[model samples]
Target: MTDTDNVSRRRFLQATGGAASAVALAGCTGGDDSDTETTTTDSGGDSKERNLKITWRPLDTLDPVASTDSASGWVIQQVNDTLANYKNGAVEIESRLATDWSIEDNTKYTFTLAKDAKFHNGKKVTAQDVVYSFERLAASDSSRRASFILNDLGVKHETKTVTKDGEEVEEYKPNSLAVNAEDEHTVSIELSEPFHASLPMLAYTSFSVIPEGIIGDVGDYEGEMSQKKFAKQPVGAGPFKFDQWQQDTKAVVKRFDDYHGKVPEVAGVHWQLISDDTARYTYQMNKNADMFNIPTSKFDPNKVSVEKTDDMGRKHGTYGPVRNGDTVNFGRVGGISNHYVGFNCEKVDKKVRQAFAYALNQETVSNNIFKGRSKPAQHFTPPAIFPGGASGYDEHAKKYPYDSSKAQLQKAKELMKEAGYGKDKKLDITLTTYDANVYIEISKLLRDKLASAYMNISVEPVKFPTLVNRGRNGKLEVYTLGWLMDYPAPDNFLKLLYPPKTDTSKKGMASYVNWSGTEAAKKATEAWDKIQANTKPTEEAQKARNEAYLTMEEANWEDAVMIPLDHPYEDRMSYDWIDVPMFGGAGRSRQMLNTAKFTGKRN
Candidate 1:
């Protein structure tokens, strides 16, 4: 679910009832057969300079932390700048607000801010603001709820001093405050534990630094999620400044001339909430929309006349040949996401789950159903982190490779028999899914495959939020959904599913499927403790972390706690003549469009 920014495309689509808004789904934008005339700022006849028309499916919220969908993260990208930047599909790290940074023993990271960065409010950005931004993410202050960064840091600050090898060193505290400003320009972030994930984790959207003055107000966070004024009217130190946001309608932003980094060439950006996919695609096909999630039909070359090519020269069908239909442009990057089917572990028997996992045919779905638009997932983490290689550390012993052979089904049937569902007894299960063309089809696939195992699966299609809510309430036997990665890391994928611990006090599985009570869950929890205890913030630490995560994943495959579906390939397309630098990968930070330039229209 690269919508993951894509999943967001569908979240608000059903609600919009109009043109395609931002891909409110995890990142997959849907198209309606409805057609609507559209227009871009570009005038014809060689006068190519114009405003960028960025269309999306819909946006339910403007609040960054409260933004449950990736489309909102897309909005945050245009307005806010995080600590650093990701380029070439998150393979390289470039300087953004921070000019230089260093890490000590993987527990501490010091970032030096670029002097020229200024907020649209004309406030000078300082280390104090950065520290405040990070702290706010984990703060329990009632103004709002932050989803991404809190997964990394706890709600409260804890710290302690200890002696180590004849020297005093700070140890992980229960409620340790992790980030602080050493001086005006130097921001020091100290984790309680040797959390090697601080770098990539900081790259998430919710980690975007805002002016301290904005959030420093006494009542800044004391309001309902949507009513938080600061969240709606965001101020940031990025190339684009928020102009206007009409919820579910459109969002507008203009260039921030005082931006410290590379500036955007387009005078402003206009994101229209087009709910219908076909209309959205037709408009982009006619060059009305400058950038959008290219519809699945657009990927079909015969359906549209796309003649441009990315520098790599891959056809636009799946890899992206930027300009097609009326000669548009595109930015191509493999999606940094993992789509999965979450099982309610507390209710599901391990053998039942294992049998279900073995029966899934993700390869056929990714290739045949998604038509090469997605990669068959081998593990929970996205293979995109390594850029076109295997997505896991290594194939583990419990790997349930995609095998549709009768022998595999026979084994599954044998497992079912142990559960007493084989023979005349049919295991009846209700599967919940979001109402999207692809999701509906996926549910059907699951139903079809499980039939051979004598499992009666019923598919119930509902809205994305409702499906998520049901997962929280433990209402469904199996739920079809995708969790987008905030950043590229195994922790981002593992921690949410099998948390080190589960707090029943927090409602709805704490945004995870509540896999803590099972044996597979216990093993995964144990693996996390090992990763935190032994791993450092280095290549060796990554190796250790990978090994640990692979074990945990293998265990899950064996237990069938959760079933991984696929990692949908993500793409950002525009007219080739647009000359805009582009990014759409794992980290939401990559969607920042500051450095992009609009070079006239197509040739």
Candidate 2:
């Protein structure tokens, strides 16, 4: 798990101009980029018992609130439903549990739930369920407190003093509930202040609507309610109902026959957790697994053979490596999907952090390692990811280009010296990531690039969950991560670093990025506050937010808090049998889980 697992779900989206990786279908290697034609029509519409296949690194939890990783989000998507959702490659706020929704005076958002929607246990999806799902998030021990409760909805993070041993310490928690049920079918979310991007925030699985009857009022990340019964066996108004879960093995979700939304044609979905990349690809190659992303080795030089090449000079596995059959290539699913190197501000000082940022060249990584599959990003979040930011939006990426120039590198070396790191007094540190082939290659690159510049680094690969666990403790000195957007707004990117951990239990909170109390964080928060005050999603709001971020990001670059990597173009291949309804790269990672069906005849 990268920091996105940490959202450092980058706990994850990128908005930028990027190309999709070319897909070589079996030995055929046909079709231009982004033209696999998977989304032309809906597959599995014939109403049959076809099992939808998916691959993952295993789910952390089905408890939507506590589950921070994308794998967990995928599972939650099938088992639960949000008030609103982003479907069909757009963020249009389609009605789900809520039949209709409206905004009043830019402060109150009202959603009317459908009368027919029911949970797996036959409970009707009501306004009380909606209110309970939200209040539950603000409970005593919820990891999602900052993400949805405090940050997005705009509320106070209030704390009360309590006695610990003899001394009294502050027991901080989110000041919650502008969320209430106006009536049984109607749910209203009233923010203390105007939050322009509130609806988009509801589209995230983290803000998923769960049954109040099961979890109850005070949500628990541990113990009986959230984890024991609900996390493993969930009940929601989604297209699928939870069938069974065997951690690290598989999770089975069966189609709900009486779903309010379009019922999936498939009888069920098989979420198989394939840990090994080679084994995962092997399943795809033999068509044993219906879908999986193209292996990092196909694009990364580390695992890819040099001899494999297509006529267009692109690599095809059949040229040397084994080729998978008739794969569908859907290029560059939109939004921000950037990979970055984040410094543990507690251990790495400002000067050393800046030096580390300027030490390497993104072009080398973009051209060679990524093989033009991903754009080498220069900012933490891609500007185009935000609403009203497609054209004429100012970005901080240009300020710090991929300059491995002697002047810049020299400045970096000087900073390294200033930080008391040189040949005699070296800054020794270890960078950790999950044991994925792609991440291993990335860590290796960072280690070599930083070592060449004077920051002596050792790459340490751990399990995905462990990487996220270690991130919370600030054990990693310099770690590699990419943030995936929870929603298609600048707030999603900005909020990833917002809600600075100010309390004693801050280390325990996953949102604690180790950059709290820094001048950089203060400035970023100030700019974000200005952005939040804009009242509505408009061109003026986007520009104001963009300009404010420009100042924030410039300071961030100088502070060297996070080194921007490219928002690489993501490319993926599915079998011709696969029908990918939403293909916005990482954004649609979980959205298409319910609607996606396998219609093509299997041999």
Candidate 3:
């Protein structure tokens, strides 16, 4: 039977719990009649209230160039307009301001503008604005948002041009970081060589052109944009306009009447910053909100407006009905995101790292804690993102196995003995986790496994801010973090971990990953340099990336750096009124929102 015909709304909710990455069950029953009803309410002019309650934290900033963090990006995504965007498993090339473009040469791209596109302030978006935004990002060394753009295209430092080549072949002024605008409507982006992913690179929200007048006045834009006043109160050219922002509470957005494309279906969108999962689920259960995920404790398929369930959970959990509601299953997981538990390489012993790996059982952890809500992640990329991806690298094969037994226990004990920790000795370590039951379970499993090897593990639940600072400062023993791909390219994940640079150029965000400065990391960094210098996106570059990834992975393991673990399954629930594109991450896929016409009715 067709998906709509057999799948019950309750069954779907019970199985996936509105998780975008949850596994889909087959032959379930329950239709999304609620969503239909909600959409009908909106389209039929029942009420103009378009409020969406989400379980995400508040945004950090509003500036497109400054808001590189997920929270900030979430807000700016609605308020700012990029030159291009990714959605629906494809990058839909639309005329934000620049309608079309032509590759003038390997190093140059010229874009033609659409006269109609205008900023929310009523000023026309011009080439000058584009050049200004880029230049501003380049000038600020702290601006991580500009790395993708600046790295793809060559940047000039004071009185010298930093070529992609090993040789610094130029003498220039300090204005080197600036993008030169050739004309009002047309501009040329010149690089030392052709970067294959430049087009998609431009599609990032960071590349969204801003008003030239704003940045030209801001003095010494050298620090994090999130700290900038402009980022706190920014202007943009998007379908929505920034209204007001109350930190730790909410960010209000009003529909832009002068939006160039199709006007928004609802009058306004209320992005409520609700951090408590229980609270969000409670609201969803009570119908206070038309649709949302049901909390783990409160999830019930029978009480919901719809029902859908299938066998995706049985394969992992080995129990429960074939389906459930508003739950992220432990087994069925896809989409290109990778989540790994990493260890500290600087302070931990190599043998201890391997022992930890051997002690951890991904399958057991997946089934028990995740409840079939995630997949066993092996690498940075998933099979869905590339060819042979699911089966691509054999790196994990080189290390520990999930088979825990008496023999395995002896081996782990032996390793600990060699590492100077045995029955009489113990290693003290702090493991970091976000304040979540899911992570708590993972932490406990890790602690138990490590304890088997005579390691004294302590769980430290740090606030999100403290966690970010500690991770960036390289001040943790072991921390669990998830890496979601910014784009559909390997470079997005690979390069961000170790970007290329010149001997004179200052260090950048890649330092966050290579905090140890080991010889292997240095080599991987060199490989990144070579990849950047390469002219084409050929097999040679791919091979180089593969080599870099292997070297980095090995170094991380050998040095007892971050221990990589299995990726958990993710899921998303939709209110009957909302039609989120079933392609990738909710906001990551730009196309998901492209065809979403909000109906006035409540589903």
Provide the RMSD of all predictions against the true structure, rounded to 1 decimal.
10.0, 9.1, 9.7
TM-score of each: 0.78, 0.81, 0.77
Displacement of residue 28 (Cα, Å) in model 1 is: 6.6
List lDDT for all candidates, in order.
Answer: 0.61, 0.62, 0.54
In the range 284-357, model 2's lDDT, one tens digit per residue, is 66755555566666543333333343322233331113374242433334445567777777777888778767
Off by over 4 Å in 1: 1-41, 44-49, 141-156, 159-176, 213-227, 301-332, 384-398, 401-417, 422-428, 451-456, 499-511, 582-589, 601-603
Question: For candidate 1, lDDT tens digit of each residue in 1-603?
Answer: 232122121232243222111111122321321222222344452322345666775665554555556767777877888887554324244567888876554455678899888998898999988866765665534213343444354323544787756767543342245577899999877655565445556666677888774654322443222326766787888788888777656777777778888776666667776655566666566555656666664465333333454443223432233344243443444566767777766667777777777777777768766766777766776654421235232333224554522225677787888888865889888888866557778788878877888889899987665675566565767877776766555666676655533332243234445566666677777887767665455567777776677767766775666677788766566655554554545533356665556555433
Residue range with the least summed lDDT across 10 consecutive positions in model 3? 23-32
TM-score of 1: 0.78
TM-score: which candidate is best?
2
lDDT of 1 at 571: 59
lDDT of 2: 0.62
Better of 1 and 2 by lDDT: 2
